[model samples]
Structures are given as C-alpha cells and as structure tokens.
Target chain A: MREIILSFPKQFKIGFKAAKGIKVLGNFKKLLICGMGGSALPGEVLKIWLKEKEIKLPVEIHRNYSLPFNVDKKTLTIIISYSGNTEETLSAFKKARREKLKLVAITSGGNLLKICKRSKVPLVVVPKSYPPRLALGFLFSSLMKVLTNSKIIRGISREILSLESKIKLKKLEKEGKNLAKKLKQKILLIYAPEKICVLAKIWKINFNETSKVPSFYNCFPELNHNEIVGFESFGKNFHTILFIDKSQNPKILKREILTAKILKEKAVESSFVFLKGKGVLPKIFSNVILGNWVSYYLALEHKKDPLEEKLIAEFKKKMKV
Target chain B: MREIILSFPKQFKIGFKAAKGIKVLGNFKKLLICGMGGSALPGEVLKIWLKEKEIKLPVEIHRNYSLPFNVDKKTLTIIISYSGNTEETLSAFKKARREKLKLVAITSGGNLLKICKRSKVPLVVVPKSYPPRLALGFLFSSLMKVLTNSKIIRGISREILSLESKIKLKKLEKEGKNLAKKLKQKILLIYAPEKICVLAKIWKINFNETSKVPSFYNCFPELNHNEIVGFESFGKNFHTILFIDKSQNPKILKREILTAKILKEKAVESSFVFLKGKGVLPKIFSNVILGNWVSYYLALEHKKDPLEEKLIAEFKKKMKV
Candidate 1:
C-alpha cells in the first residue's frame, strides 16, 4: 500500500506548485473548474469550503470530457490536469477555446501546459512530483485563489489558518480525539448540492477507501425524490445518517432538517454532522480534513490501516487499464 | 400483493387514452423527457429501444427537476405524469416554458394536464388507471408513436404487435426449475451497460420486491473501475453474479465474461444470461419483460407474490409526497 501511495506523488506535486502560483479572482459570471480522477479532488475541496458563502455567480466543477453545452463567453473554464495530459480536460479545453471562454489552467509540463503556453492562457504550473489524489491540496488551493481573485466568492484563509496545522500527519494522529470520533457508530451519507458535488463524492470515496465501510453521496434535490424513500428499507442498519449539509437553499435546508427528523423515528441509528465552513477554501478544506479524521478513527476501530485498499491496485493492473 | 397486481391494468390504460391526441414534432431541435418514479421507466424503455436501433438524434431524460443548465431551443420537452402530477416534472415544465422549448406532454389529467391545456403545448392524455409502475408499456408506446410521427425515430407498431405475445412468461418459469431455487443461497449481482440497462435495474428491483433478496446494479466501465475488486472479497460467503449480456461492445463483452470467470475462480457462484435481441425494440422489450418473468419465478420459489411493494407506497404517504 505504501509503495502504491508513493508512486503517484510526482504527478501530484506538479499540481501543488501550480496552485501556489495562481492570481486570485474577484468576480465572474460563473466559475467552472474542470478536472477528473485524482486531480479533481482539489476542485472538490474548494467546493466544500465555499458551501456556505454567498456567491453571486454559480461556482461549478465539471468532471466529464466536454464543457457544459450551456457555457458561453461569460463562463470561466478552469482547465486542470496534474499531468497536463488528461484527455477529457484537453477535449473540454478545445471546446472552451472554440467558445472563446475565459480560461485558466493548472497543470505540470505536458500537453495542457503546451496548449496554455501557445494560447497565452492564464496558466498555473505546479511542481511535478506526486499523484493527483495526493496533490488535492495544491490543485484545490489554486482554484480557490483564482475564485477569490475573480471575486466570485471570498477566501477564508484566516478562518482556515488552523488548516495548516490540521493537515500534517502528526496533527492527524493527535487530533483523532477531536474530529469524526462522533461518527464511530454512524453511517456517513454525504450530500453535496452544487453542480457536480465534487467534495461530496470525495467524502464518500474516502469513507470507502479509508474506513472500509459502505458510504454514499448524492447531489441535492435529486436525492429528495427517490433516495429518501430508500430510507424506509434501512430499518435501522445504520447508526447515523450524516448529511454533508451545505447551504444550497433555505427552503432545501428546512426540508432536509424535517426529512432527517422523520427518518430518525425509523432508523435504528441516526445523527447529523453540521459541517462548519467559512469561505470556499475553508468550507471544503474543513470537510476533507474532518473526513480524513473520521475515517482514520474508523480505521482504528476496525484495526485496519486507513491507507489500505488491499486489492484495488491489483484489480486495476489486471484490468490493463 | 394480489390486489396490487390487479390494479396495474387500470393505471396502465392511461396510455391508450394518451395516444388519442398529441402534437407532431416538427422543427424540434431535440427531444427531452422529464419524469421520475414509475412513469420514468417507460422513457428509459424508449431510450434503450431507440439506441438499439442506432437512432442518434439527441434525446435527454431529466430524472430530476433541474434540466442540465444547457438545454435550449430546437429542444422538445416531454412531461410525463401518470397521476397527472409530479413536482419535479412540473418544475421542469415551467423551465421548458421559460426556455421556449417545444412542449409535448403525457399524463392522465393532473396539474400538468391543466397547464398544457391552457397553453398551446400538445398533450397526449393517457387514460389514468392502475399504479404508474404497471403503466410502463403505455408510456413507451405513446412516446414511441409521437417520436415516430416526427421522424425522430422509426415507428414501433410492429414492435407493439409483437409485445402482445412476445413475453413468453413460461420460459423463465422453466429456468426457475433449475436456478431460481439456488438464488436463495447467494447474493445476486446484476450488470447492465448504459444504453439499455433499465432492464438490469428493473431486474434488481423485482428481485428486491419479489424475492425480498439483496441485489446490486453496476453500470459497465464504472464497474470495471471499482466493483471488479469486490468479487475477490468472498472467501466463504455465498454470492451470485448475473451478467445481462445485451448489445455491448465485443471487447466489453469479453471483459465481462472475464470478470465472471474471475469471480467463479474466487469461489463465488455466477451465471450469464445471454440475451439475443432481434432489433432494438425487441431487445429492450424482451429484457424488461424478462425481468418481470425472473421476478415472478423467484417469488414463486419464495412462495411470495411478485407484486408486493406495499412498503414503497407506505413510504410515499409518510413522506407526504
């Protein structure tokens, strides 16, 4: 597992460096940060932090191979790839360029970098070192900075100053008592209502990979209709139903709280984790860092390493993917 | 359960009524259907049939209230509501109106019916009876006819003619003599590719409500990424994998077969249901109906009625939805 973790860092570090070099934003019609796979976690982290902030323009994170067909000149397309070589990002970049979209790019030295250089696009070139998954912080921070510069939303570096202390290996080990211990008997059901819900997915994956437990994520309004009914079958299998609650709509919030109470009557176990967020960076960073805590504690309970996904690498290799 | 089964027909007959009046789809940019719950099943059926026929006109199915922020003119929006009302569909109808999207509707006569009537949008008012779940056929046939009239896709009159007798329910009843009894001893996994996978999901749901068994659904490519590893974990637990091999790429088909072999090697029970589709409609129709047959057989094995989902209805009442 350690060897597997070590191999992806080179690609990730490049993303980190690029994030550090970005100019902050102050305002925009819309902000869309596009990335996929491990590289996209950073964009997701940014979304979690911005979960509560009042932003005028919709901040979106696109993960698919093409730009949103709705996007136009007023939209800002953030082309991101840790290796600067993701095919989907490149395809979207081409479309964004064709649409004359306002663009910013984050990547290492690869096709993405070359394209950015050729086109004179705002490029954040990171140090080439780790895998995209590990470099989540780097990619996310860059996007966060850019959003701040555009004034699409405010940045919460001061609120998240504690983030620097919390992210380290030693701090995670010590703060195990502070965060996610509340989830010991809980089943984490993450909610991200924003377009793409990048951070919400990250919470689910981390719960699976780190905690080795069944976890799920859903975008808002969508979950309101079908999955809510699914709770009827849960019949007390879970101790807690953690809503990665973010402020999407006041009406939605009221509905969600009512829905939670309704389920508490039937669920064998139920609890809510009201996530605390400040700005785009802090809100998302807080969730990820807190998730990291909860998952690690869960690992301790199961007596398993939080880092182990015993068969994933072997499965990937066998698939020849 | 017996009562529920008897009630499906009345709800389904709404389709026969809806076929009476509908608009032609001329100068329409694309067709998008907005539906949720039981009504959505028919649209899924139509999409798979269309794809099987290589019908390539862009068709979008909105399973939620919000349209993908990109839809616009040249787009035809279809609102389907068996009960004549679905909140998400209503919200979407409003959006479609705002976007000036061409509108055609299918409903028994609810708010959606009233709205369409007051407006110039054409409405195919299906006779509303039975539970929406049982009315899947009517929606499929009516939508197919409208799309056919617009030259969006070829007509399915022959397909409808064939559907009357094509569901040789006894065929699966025979398969049950051998395998259905064994399903009780293992976990059931259902696989379907994106194009026509509704049958796959339908199959799983039927298993859940009928046999009351645990089942899982994995779309291809995505499954190739994560769930392939899950099969390796069963050192001793009884498990079964069902591969719904429909129209998949040869390479992908090979990958699925290989996955089955690997599961078998890991001491898991697995079966392959090789589906032969005469055409797109036959393939989609046969698989969906096959799902109904499989559920019946499994229910018979358990001495349970295939139509018992009282809990699902009870849930709707509790949610006040």
Candidate 2:
C-alpha cells in the first residue's frame, strides 16, 4: 500500500508509455467503460475530468455484465480488469465484441489480457504487483493516454508529467493523520462539488476497504436538494468531509459552505478540504492521493491491516463455487 | 401521505396526460434529464426502463447546476422541478437555453414553469397537490409520454395505464408494514438489481424523509465486487433489504442470493422482496410503491410525521437568503 502511494507519480510516466503501440480509432459518439470495484472508479474520475474540461462526448461507466443497451458501432468500449479476470468485465468485453463495438482493454495478465491479444483488440498492460484499488494512478493515466490518442482530450501527458513533482506525499500524510484523528470513531459523510464528486466516492471506497469502515458520499447541489434533510436525524455519529474545488460553479460553492454551516448547527461535525492543483488532472490526483493517505492513516488508527479484504476474498471464493 | 399513496395509480393516469399539449421534437442524439430529488429520480427510472427495452440512445441524468458538457443541439433536455422553484433545475434550464439544446419542462406552477412559458419551451405541468417525492407517478408517466412522443421509447403508456389495475396497493401496504416491523430500529442497506436499482434509491429517500432514517443503496453485480466486503464490519446495527427482480441477469440474481447468504453468515439480517411486476415499468413502480408504504409504516411505528422535512425546509429557507 505504501509503495503504491509513493509510486503514484511514477505510474503516470509508466502509463504514458504503456499504450504507445496502440492506435485509437476516433469518431465514436460515446465511450463506455466496463469494469468493477477499483477498476471501474477511474472511469468515473475520467468522466468528471472530461466534464470539467468541457469535452462534448458522453462517457458512461457500466459496472455489470453486458454493455449498455446503447452500445453500437458508434460507441467505443474500454474494458478494464486489473487482475484481468473480473467476470462481469469479461462478460461485457465479449458482449461488446459480439455487438462489434470498437474496443480497448487494460489489464496486467489475466484472461482479459489473453482474450484481447487473441482477438487482436488494443490493450494497455500495466505492472501487476499492487492491488487493483491501489493502482489508480496506472489505471487513470492509461485511460488518459487512450483519450489523448483518440483526440478526445489533448495535452494531458504534460500535466501528468508535471504532477510527479507537484504532489507532496509527506505533507499529505501529516494532514491525513490529523483528519483521521477527528474521523476515527465517526461515520463519514463525504460531500463534494458535482465535477469532482467522484472523489467523494473514491474516499468512501477507500474508507470502506482500507479502514473497514462504513462511509457514504453525496455531491453538492444534488445533496442540497434531498440529503441535506437527512443530516438532521444522524446526530453526532457522523462527520462530514466537504471536498471544495474552487473552480466549481460559484452557486455550488456557496451551497457547500452553507451545507457545512447547517451540518454544524445540526451538531454534525464537518470539515472542508479545498481541492489542490491548478488543472483538473492534478486536482483530481491530489485529492485521490490525499484520500489514500487518509484511509491508510484511518486503518492505522484502528489497528487494522489496510490491505486486508477477507470478506471480499471469501465472497469471490463462494462465487467461484 | 395516505392520500398520495392511495392515489398513486390515479397519478399515473393524470401524469399520462400531464403533457398532452406539449409536442416532442424527434431526432435527438441523447436525452439529458435535469432535476434533483424527486424530480431527478424519474429520469434514473427512465434510463433503466429504456435500457430494458433496448433503446439505443444514451440517457443521462444531471442533478446539479447546468447541463452536462455533452448537451448539444441534438440532445433533448428535460427540466423537471415538481414545485417549479428548485434552484438547481432552474440553473440547468437557463444553461440549456444558452447552449441552444432542445428543451422541455415538467413542473407544477413555479418559477421553472413561468420561465418555460416566457421562453416558449414545451412544458408538462402535473398537479401541485402532493409533495414532490410522492409525485413520482406523475413525473415518471409524463417522462414516459415525452419519450414515447419523441419516438425514443414505445408502448410505455399502455404498461403504465395497465399498472393501475395490476398494482394492489392494499396488499403492498400489508407487505410494507410487515417489512417495516423488521427494519425498525435498524440502519438500512437497500440493494437491488441494476435494472430496477432506482427503486432502491427511492426507498432510501423515502426512509430518510419519512422515517428519518440513515439508509444507503447499491446495486447488484457492482455491490458484489466491493460493498459486500464492507458488510463484515457493519455489525448487527444494519439490516439489508434486497430488491430481487426475477428477470435480472441470471449471474446477477445468483450474486444477489449469494450476497444475502454472505450477509447472514456475517450475522447481518437480510430479507428479500421479489419484484412483482411483469415488465420493467410495472416492476419498478411496484417496488417504489411498496417502499413508500414501508417508509410510511416505519414513521407510524416510530411515532414520527411522515410528511415533515423540517431540516430540508430550513435548509431551503437559508439557501434563499
């Protein structure tokens, strides 16, 4: 886990070259990302990142078996399975092929990799040492390369290379430890602006997997409409972390502040983290790295192994039978 | 609350004609439904419904300020604000207009309605008598009408009309009350198959609003990959309600059963509600109606007012300032 966190910046460089030999076919009307768990998260992050950059094409993430009903010749489907063996993703990849949709695959060396190779589908191969959840940097950067190659996004490699020196891990760890202290015994309610709301979800997943804690996330503007009402009954068992990106729409920013204030009045502890980084890529990565540290520190505080997922292993084992 | 629940079937009929005078323009490349809370829930339900029927165009739901970056001339943007005054929906409406996207509005007479009127946008006005959450029938049916008229979907109105006679509310209420007894004094983790997952979300909202409970939802196949792991640490405080649709992907149905079994091994109580309806529309509505009764009965058992949303009202009041 520590190695994955420390090597995040390096993964960007590795990911940049991982897809060098693959050529992207442009003119797809939509992009469908198929994966589950950690593999699926980067797609969501990319969706918001693309939205923040004002990209015009719709990006959809499908976490289940089969491609969306809308998958067609005009759709580009990317199948991601870090271990290369996730059943749902394999199902989706085969369905995408049967439907003859343009396809890409990202994996280490599981069945997904073998199938892609046999089918002559484009593939991006990353190293397989780390757990899928900790390999966000490689997954996200590879996806960025695909988008860049397809001409859907431009000049991300420069931003990604700059991120190596820009992110300060030690400082993030200190901040994470401080925040973990406050969040130790509390149920977490993470809130973020809509553009970067995926970060909140990432945080929830990190907390769930790493710290073995129950957490939930919601985005502002939307949460303001309904979930804000929910905080009234939650009491002191909840602590909210608001991910505030200054670049978000001013109205949403105001709502975030007001929401924190309301949470305080309702006696629910709350804190705000202004998103770091000048560009969307950096901002998203910065928040993700910070969340990783937070969840790790939370695990340490709880005396739990950050890498353990016994129940998940058992569930998968049971499914195999 | 009782009036709204008992008249849900009638609301579907009322919603069928809610947009009679409005003409839908065809040939849109994408459908973007913009709303929040109850207004937004229908769009999610519609997305799944369209998927079930194999509609080829992508349908996306936008719950925050402004439309998705993909909104264009070929995108059909529906703005729904039951009260016509929701700030986020209003913001999206203006943004859609500025972008010159095709527009439609569904609302009671509020600021959204007036603006749509002045802007000459096609509008669908449902009755203003019920709380927005309770007005799902009207919103969903009106949306179905718009989709049918635009040729994005076919034959939904007939299914919705048939729902009136097919759905037995009294029986649903009894089932709901029985489930509510089990769910009382427990945190809820509602699970559903991906196709009808919106019902899980509707149940969460109903529980939060009516019973003042903290509830969360995730769909099958996806949950099997991650959230099922979190259940190990969730303790006995959490009770899970699995909404099982018989027609879901066979693998997903197996995962749902296995997930319930795993939860039992973890000592987390769970119960399954097999969806009753034949088609996606009827099935979704059946679960939603039953969820409504469950939440209502939960409120009654807890001696709480099901209709009250004091924190939300207060939050809105503060936002206006």
Identify the candidate with maximal DockQ. 2
lDDT of 1 by residue, A1-321 (tens): 334222222323333344554553433566677776666676555544443343324556665456655565667778888788765578788888888788888886689999888878888876665444545666665565556555655644444334443334444334443545555534556655544366666666666666655454655544544344334344354444444456554444554565566557667354555555544444555555555566667666667676655554454455455
Estimate the Cα RMSD of every predicted model relative to the unseen true structure. 7.3, 2.0
Report the lDDT tens digits of candidate 2 across residue range B83-175: 998888888899888887788889988898888888789999899967788999999898888778777777666788888888889999899
Q: Which stretches of candidate 2 lie over 4 Å from their true place?
A: A24-27, A150-152, A231-234, B98-100, B150-154, B231-234
By TM-score, how accurate is candidate 1?
A: 0.69
TM-score top scorer: 2
Error of 2 at B135 (Å): 0.5
- Candidate 2 to truth, TM: 0.95
| Model 1: number of backbone collisions | 38
lDDT of 1 by residue, B192-298 (tens): 65445576666665566566554546554444433454333332343444555654555456556666766677676666776645666656655555555565566
- Against the native chain B, each candidate's TM-score is 0.80, 0.95
